[model samples]
Target: GWTYGLNGELRKATRISGIEDFSINVFRRDFGLVPIKVATWGPFVLLNMDNEILQKDNIDTDNVASEWLGSSSELFSLNGVDTTLTYVCRREYIIECNWKVFCDNYLDGGYHVPFAHKGLASGLSLDSYTTSIFEKVSIQSAEGGSKEKEDDRLGSKAFYAFIYPNFMINRYGPWMDTNLAIPLGPRKCLVVFDYFLEASFKDDKAFIERSLADSEKVQMEDIRLCEGVQKGIESPAYSTGRYAPNVEKAMHHFHCLLYDNLIN
Candidate 1:
């Protein structure tokens, strides 16, 4: 594919295969630009421009979402059926905070769920949640709470994956979504949530509405908490905080990645 640029130059476009879970093709004038990785996972397409700092990562097959694209995939099977999922909805949440703060809140993995997100906490059993830290990826999973019992569509569990830097994939029953945490400035960021749903539920208006309502509530809570943290960090009285070894391993792992990239 090709398109005329602002200056009337014919820009060339091509697809970069096998990097992302999906197919990604972009138009650019020359090869000087970074490589774009397209990852299509569970009905959503993720487009990423490879960061030179972390391009050398050796990701595990289990942790890579693209592996699920295979006909023989097992991790994200829908009721034992191996098939591709369908696209659904998407929304973005803008936050007045450093991108790290939003992600840090995500990686905290403890304490905040019960206290900060009361409504969302009802749907999740914090006691059942567990986090597994990997080389460049992390997985957090938990069994459903009361909400699961009410919704027959959702299975008995949910899992979330965090790819290094700023990408997140969340899977709940037959629904999946990815969060691209794009940092706009030092204290501003945009968290784009692209939702993918099982094609079977495409016409279920009530189900979709209920699901989105619940998700929006949780997102609002996160925005409030993260925005507050960003403002709090500017306080002269507060410098740094401690991390609980068992509960906060993910946050530590994320920080280490940032430090390594900034230094070397």
Candidate 2:
């Protein structure tokens, strides 16, 4: 489309065949300016031109075909689904410490799962939990965590998976997956919790929505407590804190990894 410069001089056209290089050059010569941006989204080539020329030449799509009436142009064609799928979420909160402190707490479930996540820990006995580590990845799973229980109504399992550089996938039976602790700044972060459902439940919109709502509520709870921890870490008297041998393993694991990387 033309803006208000040399109006009626810049025009657009559609053809049954593509335009040849020579014909394009000839048209550009008459118009006196080449296109700034030639954008194709789906089957459409949207053209933008200077405004003043378009007004002066009384140029529109029809004007272009009449002026360049030749056999050099062909139809516009495009393929299907020239697009990609993406998902993103954003949140902002006030935090009051060096961001790494928060990260340390999240990386290891060995420490705080017993303390910070008391309710979560209760459902899956911490005594039976085991940690498995890989390069930049670790998961804490209960001894029988993967097995479905005979009385598994609330569907509880305790396992935490850490994907390095600030994302955790916490699994709780067939119900939940928490995409945890994404940093927003040196002291702030955002977390997302996504829940999974059985294939049979895929068509159940109500069930899926309920699961998501529950997941979100739990995430908010985690954020509230984590933000509080951030404040405590900011105290001038606090430099470093000791981890509980059982409860803070995740925190320690995370801190040591970070320390090793930072120092190296």
Reference-based lDDT, each prediction: 0.71, 0.50
Tens digits of per-residue lDDT, candidate 2, 75-187, equal 10110111221112233434443456556656555455565555445456657766655555566666333344321312544456665556655444344343545566777
**Candidate 2: how many backbone clashes?**
39
TM-score of each: 0.73, 0.53
RMSD of 1: 9.2
Q: How does residue 70 of candidate 2 score in lDDT? A: 22
The number of the candidate with the highest lDDT is 1
Mark the 10 consecutive residues where model 2 has the least summed lDDT: 72-81
Tell me which residue pairs clash in candidate 1.
20-38, 20-39, 21-39, 21-40, 22-39, 22-40
